[model samples]
Target: MTDFLHLLHHELLLSLVIVCMLILKLADRGRSGSSWSNLLNVLLLINFAGGLLIEAEGSLFDGMFRSNALLHFEKNVLSLGLLLVGLLATPYLRNHKHSAEFHILIASTLLGMFFMLSAGHMLLFYVGLELATIPLAALAAFNLNRGESSEAGAKLILSSAFSSAFLLLGISFVYGTCGSLQFEQIALTVSGNPLQLLAFTLVFTGFAFKLSIVPFHFWTADVYQGAPIPVAAYLSVISKAAVTLVFISVLYSVFGALQATWTPYLLITALLTIITGNLFAMRQDNIKRFLAFSSIAQVGFILTGILGANVDSEGIVLYFLLIYLFSNLAAFGVAGLISAATGKESILDYRGLHASNPRLAWTLTIALFSLAGVPPTAGFFGKLFLLTSGASLGNYLFIGIAALNMVVSMYYYLRIVKAMFMETTAQPIGKIPTGVAPAIALALCIAGILVSGLSGSFYEHIHLLTLSY
Candidate 1:
């Protein structure tokens, strides 16, 4: 009972924070009170701090919500991603009319994501997933007056509903077959049978939709193209990271025994996603659509880590994800910052960005290079570890194909860099005050890429975390 209460307390605390924010919104309605943005920043900081403390307190409640060193690390990593997203959204919201509600929705979504990361049962996982997802569709359409934004929202919701149906059906099948929803119990019941295979495939379909893998990724480009930059960043980083964490947990825990059954499928999916994403990205001139496809390609690289047979694969995946979170956010942060300053979101609008806003251009350049897996950055190390792990598994074909994909990916990623540096601008780009929050966030991302590369300890720590579980 004590343990359960402790676990409950953490969940309740996040819920309380959400409710408090709602009440504050109500009180501020019809009046220009203190800037909700300021309050939100403070509240978000506190929420992040609270999540850390809760993670440190570790798991409570029997095995129902156990938090160990690994999960604690993952929670902190995710919280950092959330914080960065919020900071990036600040300048974006400042210029928009409907800013406050947007921040509130993001906060609420982060609360759900926090729970999703620590979920110990299928029920909790599914609930957390939904809680994290539903708000995002609305956020996608926060620009209510824009037809593109509304269409993006509709698409996201429709696709999300489809995925949720698949997930629920899979859950029902698993429950019917295994007679239990707990990961351990389900794993115990799973055998090489048609029902188990069906359950696995069904669940994988839902997760693949979230991960934006091939065949399940048709909505990504349109949504990215239409949604506001901040919302797109939220989807790219926070939401995707949370889902990936759960996906890893599910793969490593519930389906560890079925590796032989699932590895080939995962391998095939990774290759397909890599090829398709890169091919589509190469032809995109719209920055958001380009990034949408780029993110899909990145997911393929992430899949390589999951396919690793090493004991440290989980930790490696998480560490790489952390690097990805920072690199991708920095890229989007620059885009959002630029978009807010100039009403331009297209790649060509960046003509002579280096001359107009050197700081933003250079920051974006570094971010792009990092994403392309250039050296002395966190992204490079992430790819190195993934490749190393894959090579160790003796999957030469997989490693070789991944290497080729990396080369292909560089072509598209470099296109953005080339546009910023080599191209000439027609007009001087105006600089917006990135503010303390976003500046700090960008700095941290840059620092993370550098620090993670310089320090072997970072990788070692991640290795330990993967092994701990």
Candidate 2:
């Protein structure tokens, strides 16, 4: 137990916190209004800062578990995002019947994500993957009063089952080829063999499902639309961030031996994903579904960094997500506020939003501009760095297609901005009573996006992290 405590410092903190929350829930038993949420929120913020402060970096648990510069950086960034996400989620979760349980589940998911980020072996990765997934289904179905929530949970479970099956098949094949489940063993053993080829193909397909890459992306839009706003936000940012790190780590570290075999494939899939995701997002009326498709489009940009697989590209990818965490969450944060106040979820309902609630309108405007990759905003820098890094390796065609997708994406992202500022409706949602927690969350997101963008030191810090790993 002492060994576990020292080795997985943050994960242990999370585990203990979850237990404490569960006990608190039981103690509160059937209370009309539970204040445990406020306590949990404060505790979680402390955990996030403490997790960031811990500099202990090593491998333990027989080398199956590891924590290094890479893992530490990933955890810290994810913790910061979750800290803000928790703040944003609070307003919506306050009235939940099982609010304490919801926090417990979120902590469990984050614990699993930590495990996944640092898994040294295939079996360890699988364990972490499933742990991260199970709680999301329950969270998606949390609003049991709504039929769409139930349907979203069903779709998520079904897709997760398929992904797991594919992942297991890949694992078994790779194990048979290498006679070991350790990533180092596989890296040393794998070559251009048919078995290695088959294994990586299957494994990447599972990753594609999680990242919502093309062909495996059918479930993304509906799930995002139906789940509770906070759950949708969780899936949008947290799940994607953790999965992005693990997926690239596997491919970049273990299967790098097959780059010639995989690079072209990544490029093709990226092209298709960019085109499909942007096209789909253009037609969406629902706000969450629009961002869902937008997330898919953004993944195409992120994949380019993975395709390059260099220190600079790695830094660029992580930096992009740092700002992306803020930009995307800001948009969702505004959406949550509007939803809470007006109970309106459609883009059309956002018409003339500026007339009454200029704060919400401008907050969302900044977020949308950043997401659209417009100048002086973080999203523009994200795309610029991503394209430059990928293109440096002479990926002109893929870069060209990606640029086109950016143009396509801009049209839809600005659609909401237009609705809020330029258009008007007979029934305009006026003057949402924005609360303190949500207001702070929005400010943090905007600040993150702007500070990261204008500050070259941020890129230097990211470079230092990549060098450490």
Worst 10 residues of 1 by lDDT: 54-63
Instruction: Write model 2 residue lDDT over 1-469, tens digit each, in one string.
Output: 6556666888887888888888888887865333656678787888787787666667887779988766787898888877787788777876777777778888888889999998999888999998999999988988889999999999999999899899899989999988999988889999779988999999989999999999889999999999988888888888898999898889888898998888887888888888999999999899999989998988888888777777688888888888788999999999987886677899999999999899889999999899889989888898899898889779787788788878888899888899999998899997788777778889989988888878789888888888777
| lDDT for 174 (candidate 2) | 93
- Report model 2's TM-score to 2 decimal places: 0.97
Per-residue lDDT of model 1, residues 334-393, tens digit only: 998888777788888887788767888878888887888999777888988888876777
TM-scores, one per candidate: 0.95, 0.97
TM-score, structure 1 vs. true: 0.95
The lDDT of model 2 is: 0.86
At residue 72, what lDDT does model 1 achieve? 61
How well does model 1 score by local distance difference test? 0.81
